[model samples]
Target: MEEDSTGPDAEVGAGAGRGDDQSMRGLVEALARRGELVDIDRPVDPRFELGGVLALLDRGPAVRFTDVKGSALPVVGNVLTDRERIAAALGVPKSGILDALSAAIASRQPTEEVTVAPCQELRFPAADVWREVVTPTFFEKDSGGYITAGMIVAHDPVTGHRNASYARIKPLEETTGFVGIAPNHHLSALARSAATAGRGLPVAVTLGSHPAIQLAACFYLGLGDDELEHAGHLLGEPVRVVRATTSDVLVPADAEVVIEGVLRVDRPVHEGLVSEYHGMYEDYGDGCTLEVTAVTRRADASVQVILPGLAAEHSFLGALPIAAGLRHALRGFGCRATDLAVTLSGGGRVDVVVALPPEQRKQAKRAILGCFAAVSMIKQVTVVDSDVDVWDAEHVQWARTSRMRWERDLVLVPAVPCDRNVPMQQDGTVTKVGMDATAKPGDRAAGNELAVPPRETMDRVHGWLTSDGLGGKVRPTPVVRGALHGAHEDGR
Candidate 1:
């Protein structure tokens, strides 16, 4: 017997997720090692049960369903569900995410081209194995199975610039499906250009690469920009790429699966109900059809599924990249913000919180305006002191309530063109609001003091804080009689 060599276990061995926490498998392995990944060995259905499990664990660690009922490959979900997890994959601290992302965009490196792509080791007819591989229908209202995590890669027909972005793909037929692309997305522009020249756009959907690649794809860069190069900077190494079977477009060499296809922009189809960031279904009339040419995958690869619809993974994917851009834009506006977060409450699309020094409170207006200008999806902004954590909703709300005066601090800018998916959008425009929550100048702000318990006393009472002790009822402290007598004698 001989072991067929493919390059590493290709993520099948016992040590699969042990090494660098960069690739999807490796990150899951790392999470498992850190007790951040939960495993369900029992047989589970991918249709709704799998999504149910992921939704239950949405606020927790990553999950691996070892036996998906109808699929040959296992399914992994919620891999990048939290900021700390994302930071861990990038090998950076939570506070440094914006800096790391900004550097990656500005200092991009080229990808490494490889002859043998792990994703193409095994090839199957597109029409034959749509279900053999994993495709989960997350919600009941959804029309059918959707590939939410896949990054669609296509080069511009005019400039030859490669573009990668995340689009929802609902497989309608064995070889054809609807690709949900907003009119403003770069892929739509690319597809339109190809249609103008009387042809379908060539595209290859890359799935299960390094998490950085996914993050890179979410970025809203200029039309001529290439995110693959930026991913190299984020990964601290060049992303491995290989040519697709049906097209010249290059995809991640290490991706678990690659669905090669041609997008027909001219022939549009109903995309069914798409789960928006707002946890609601969005029916965008119709979208372009994707005619899959070939489907390739790793022999023992685990199909990666990012649970969509208000899940943490969904929010992080949409929020992190744009927040990084907003941070850079604010810097250019002379606002030295230390932290920025696109809140999950706003579906990671419309709400954001920024933190800066108290002295820079006056610049809150500029920061707010900067956010609205940078990302059209963002409709609400809150600026807080650097000491307040932007990631915590309660802290942000407290800052707004404590420091902001309703009449003076509320700022609204009207008639802004934003994401059509926004619920309040009327006639392609929406009003944006910003709150100056940073400390205000005056005697009221200056005289206020924050009370905190002594550190040593709190430490001493950690185990003793109970209903009978310090928790249930407030008890008065008694002064030592001996000390009081001594003080009285000396004073008299």
Candidate 2:
């Protein structure tokens, strides 16, 4: 249930899992050794070319842009595109990701601070440095360049507890950028407090961190929760942090790049049209502004970039933590959430699939409401029996079609708080829908049995796939999605 976090210098032996690498560079090298890295030597432009390649190569290998047309620093994209990749990053099987993340969040570990850090190897003044160093525009949107994968670190003004989360940073002036901080996000709330005191919020933007730490930053914890501690637990060791040069906020010791800045409460900047995780452009108007004070990086630092809307990286990153948080919350609410998944089709934020027990069918509405309350971003909830595979979209859809009675099983909540950008939503309110996709306890005999292949046959097919070098090219079908046979009685 717990593992030691190995320092950056620790060597992970051959056949080690992704968890063995706790630094960005370490994961990069590991991926390279496993032939999962795509090294691009050709010089690419940062404005649209680098992002274009990433978009074109979505769901493909992790890309390393070895050459940038204008800057000396390289860029990497699609660090973890799909759920399988996310699972590998967390050092767990795909089926165990939700439990692993939930458990990690519950058992927090203390973070260890170090004196020297590789991230500070090269230091530069903030003035006019961002335009040259930070990544350029990812998409051809109306706005300028943005940092899509930066993990912002901020501390609670009253508690001093640190929190790390991902937000799109829109670089405007040479030393200033506008950050899209939703009103519900903890960072936004902290910024509000700092504003009332007539002071700026000290923050550090870390790019290119370990996969575990990167994923940990996405967890939807309480306001004062220390995400770094949860990240340590996920890593099986304490996260090593270094005091920033220009601020008290400590950044990951092995981060590829760190930008120290003060988020100004008095200076709010309007963000032009920008792409969001929903695969669409929306103008969030007048978000928080940050004045960069310092920028530091490794001598050969490689900037991390996530192509917004095009790849599953953005959706998958948000989905896992949301599901994990919801699972934790539902369990606390007395619901047996065997598994949870946030579907990509829902843009990774709006829809969720939860698997529970047949006997708990009556409580499905409670579970649905519990999830919506736990994760504010979720707009639709689907509850299925424990036998369902929430990760398989087809299986979930099948369950919805076969088990859900639209008139009886659908629960609709009107005028609920929702994202402002949702279509046709003017007052930030939307109709939330919950579907109970579980078979009736007494009608179990009326359901059809799933027709699945024999284990021996599937195993042989998998072996053949590996032998033919198509192991990565194809995935074994989700057996649970097999066609239904004649009606059969089964125990609930």
Question: How well is each residue in 1-492 modelled by candidate 1, as lDDT tens digits?
Answer: 011122222232211224343348777777787687888999897789999999999999889888889788888888888877777666665556788887776777887788887888899887855764577888989888888888999975555878889888887776887889989888999999888888888898877888888898888788868899888887777777899888888888888888898998899897767778889887788999999989888887778888887999999988899888888788899998777889998877789999876568789999999998888888899998765667778767777777788898899999988878886788889999999987766729365333444435543554366524654342322112212221222342
10 residues in a row with least lDDT, candidate 2: 483-492
The prediction achieving the highest lDDT against the true structure is 1
Error of 2 at 97 (Å): 1.3
TM-score list, all predictions: 0.87, 0.89
Clashes in predicted model 1: 1
As a TM-score, model 1 comes out at: 0.87
Model 2, TM vs. native:
0.89
